[model samples]
Target: MTDLCVEVERAPRAALVRLEGDLDKVSAPAFRKCLAGLAEEGCVEVVVDTAGLAFCDSSGLWVLVEHQRTLSGMGGTLQLTGVHGVLRRVLEVTGLRPLFASQL
Candidate 1:
């Protein structure tokens, strides 16, 4: 199994969550908690940096989708950067690309 790591950096206007390793079922809970923490902190703008994301399963995709929906409902935004390889294809194929602003 691929190890997962999440690094968060908060800025004045937004928070950057850098994801590394595999984001599968085992790690989705951590990702969700991170998002929940951001929400509780009243963060309105979030940018997820996928520079080190090695793999993302369907569960990971679900987390992203749910967070994006939640943020949009609150008039916030979720931006994705460094999306490539299998993860990129998954987003495109799943038609979830429109849910986030991609900086690839």
Candidate 2:
């Protein structure tokens, strides 16, 4: 379980959530907290920067999908950026790549 650190920054109508370190079961809780901030702010759009992500697991993917669903239900959106390698393959395999705007 690699350490996960999230840094959040807000823009006019969007929030940038930078995800650093591994994303797995151990880190999912912290990931959730990051999303909670976005929800609290009622951000119209969320940009999840995964450039620093070192790893991921099913639990991590589940959280992402949940956040996407929640944002859509709230009339907002979640966008992904800097995804690559194994994580990118996982998203592609899950067929969730098309559901959100992706910056690969």
Candidate 3:
């Protein structure tokens, strides 16, 4: 797994988290940390840019889902951007695409 890097940028109405490297089990904790920070910041809208993600596992998916739940509980939302390859298939196979606002 590549060393995961997450960079957060603020937008006018949403916060964007740019993901770099693999988003699999080995690095999912870091992703969770980033997401938690955003939650703590009282973000009402979030965009997770996965354009540079090399890989992701079920654990990663769970973490993201949890983040979405967190946002939803707070009357917020989470958006997914630039998903591709296996990650895209995972979302389809698991029928989780409809749960998120995805950027094709």
Error of 2 at 30 (Å): 1.9
Kindly report the root-mean-square deviation of model 3 from the true structure over all alpha carbons: 1.3
Of 1 and 2, the candidate ahead on TM-score is: 1
**What's the lDDT for candidate 1?**
0.89
Residue pairs in steric clash, candidate 2?
none
lDDT of 3 by residue, 1-104 (tens): 68888888986557998888888888888789888877887876998998988888898999989998889899899989999988899999999997887785
Best by TM-score: 1
Per-candidate Cα RMSD to the true structure, in Å, reads 1.0, 1.2, 1.3
Model 1 TM-score on a 0 to 1 scale: 0.94
Residue 54 of model 2, lDDT score: 91
Q: All models: lDDT?
A: 0.89, 0.87, 0.86
Candidate structures ordered by lDDT, highest first: 1, 2, 3
Q: Which candidate, 1 or 3, has the higher lDDT?
A: 1
Worst 10 residues of 2 by lDDT: 36-45
Measured with C-alpha atoms, the lDDT of residue 21 in candidate 2 is 89
